[model samples]
Target: MTLTLYSNYVNSAGERVRIALALKGIDYEYVSVGEISWEVYERINPQRLMPALKIGDQIVPQATAILEYLEETYPKPALLPADPVLRAQARAFAQHVVSEMHAIDVIRVRRFLHNQLGVDQEGIDHWQNHWFANGFAALEELLARRQTAWTFCFGETPGWADLHLTPQVTKGIARFNVDMAPYPLISGIHKACVTLPAFIAATPAEQPDYPGRVIEPKLR
Candidate 1:
């Protein structure tokens, strides 16, 4: 099976999919959208989103959807648990990161805040940080209540939650400069996840299109 992934290094959504591919030990063609011409990417995805996965002639858009496809196609590693309730929890956790936390802080949202709302850099930063804290606070409470294993969100091994958590925490530290100490469980899980080869290899800094100096934070 031939797989081609079109992604931008700076995008958290893309990073999530990339990490999943790495954990699955799937080798594919990595297309850096940042390095390529806009016309090329436009042809591939009219929406101009990063992290579009091409499986032969079929194209799967959206990072979360791509992750679900990967889990379905390659079930050996098993990103989600077999039990229906556990699977739903995993999906909800992933969605919390993507829909609740990530969706609001993406480039488009930031750009919209700056251009459309006339918000300055400080305002944008404040906005991002507030939401990050809010989401992390809720997640911390849930994890504490559930008494999640130290290794991962709901299981012994890194799964859907860990994939989403790592990238979001990475971005929170590197971009938003948020204090991770408030979310001990999240910080711990992120620390453990990044140590693995899959998470390390799929990090934004390790991507081909990464422009700036890599920020590797020492998670507390």
Candidate 2:
């Protein structure tokens, strides 16, 4: 049976898995869910999150889990390195973005939509900069230290770690304005990833309902 990925158009979480699918060159059915009513998604993911993939009859939720599953099941173009230490490092980098830096995008998006919620803009900006600076500082150090063969994040070919890193970097560029100049390796990897057909296929602007056109200034 063809794999079915359940996701909403232009969602960050969904974008994560989409990158993985593209790198693997795996053709799976994309089930696009919308914001209208999530009755179907709610049944699969109680949190009502996008990017819940249905592999055969199994229902998988959370972007991280889905990514790991895909890596394990389809190991042809391996996402993680063969070395255990490097593999752990890859996962660590992936987690650094997912766990530490993810909130910048979330809070920024919230501020953009519901400015009337009384969320202090100054405080939000301060918090966003703090997390982004701290997280990227460490990421820059890590990537610079890695002695690798490929231009991508881990070893060489795009893997689980790169899948997580690039999309978050894309979002950071689009939403947070995180400076990539300080992190040349990260930016280089991201630039390389975007040129690939998979990353191009997963771009937010290519989505079916991408705000009619590109939304500017991220939080305006």
Candidate 3:
């Protein structure tokens, strides 16, 4: 199978899939779509989203779905817990990260606020920070409730939860200067995750299209 990942460097969703591929030890081609036109990318992905995985001839869009496909296809180092209840718990965390946290505060939404709604940078910053804080606060509480925890959120080894988390937390800190001192558990997990080989490889600085400061997600 020819696995090609089409995404920009700064995209969190793309970064998650990249991290997952590295964890699974799957060698695939990385195509930086930072400069492509929407018309061109739409041909590959109908939704015109980033991190679409092309396996042979089929194109799989959406980071969550791509992660699921990878987990089912490459089941050795499981990205989810083996226990049914624990698996549901892990999925719940991922769902929050992807849907509640990301869907609301992604670059596209920010762009719409700026371009269409005439929201200034200060307003956008306040908007983004507000939503991020809400999400992180909930996650911190969840982590605090854990009786037994490992380096990652779900276990000692990195899982899908960690993949979703590392990018969001790291990006929030790196770009927006998010104050992590409040959430010790979330902050610690982000710090630990970056040290791993997979996350190190998937970071924005390591990507081919990383051009210093990346404001937009470049979901071309």
Candidate 4:
């Protein structure tokens, strides 16, 4: 199967899909949308979003959707649990990061706040930090409650939730200047995830179009 991935290195959503593909031991042609024109990207995705997966003749847009397609297509080394309740728990954890936290911090939203809404840099930073803290706090509580023996979010092996959490934590530390000290569980989980080969390989800095750029924390 010829799998082509259109993605931006800095995007958490794209990172999620990339980690999934890596864990599945799948290889594909990676195209960096950051290097392409908007017009070209719009042709690939009407929304012009990063991380669209092209499988054969079919195009899968949206990171969550792409992940689902990958899980369905590659059943071995499953990213989701077989049990229904555990699966729902894992999906809830993934959604907390992807839908709740990541959605608010996307580049488009930050640009809109700065350019269109005329929000100052401080205001934008506050916006990002607030949402990140709220999400991480909830996740910390969730993991604490579950009390799983495994180091990952759900079990011993990393899965859907770990993939989502790792990138968001990476963005939090690398971009938003969010203080991770308060969320020990999240910090610990993130530390554990990064040690894995899949997470390390899927990091933004490891991407081809990373631009050798770095963002120092403004508040933390």
Best by TM-score: 3
**For each candidate, what TM-score against the reference?**
0.93, 0.86, 0.94, 0.94
The residue pairs that clash in candidate 3, if any, are none
Query: For model 4, how many clashes?
Result: 0
Clashes of each: 0, 1, 0, 0
The per-model lDDT (C-alpha) reads 0.85, 0.78, 0.88, 0.86
Please write out the lDDT profile of model 4 over residues 97-176, one tens digit for every residue.
88888888877788888888888988987898889989999998888888464688888789999999999998888776
Residue-by-residue lDDT tens digits, candidate 2, 29-64:
877676435886788778676778887788888889
Using lDDT as the measure, which candidate wins?
3
Tens-digit lDDT string for candidate 3 (1-220): 9999999888889999999999999999988775776678888899898989999999999998899999999997999988787788889888888988899888789889988898888898899899889999988888888767777798888898899999999888887788988999988888889999999999888898899767654322
Per-residue lDDT value at 61 in model 3: 95
Report how far residue 127 has shifted in candidate 2, in Å. 1.6
**lDDT, ranked from best to worst:** 3, 4, 1, 2
| Candidate 4 displacement at residue 99 in angstroms | 1.2
Q: List the candidates ranked by TM-score, beginning with the highest.
A: 3, 4, 1, 2
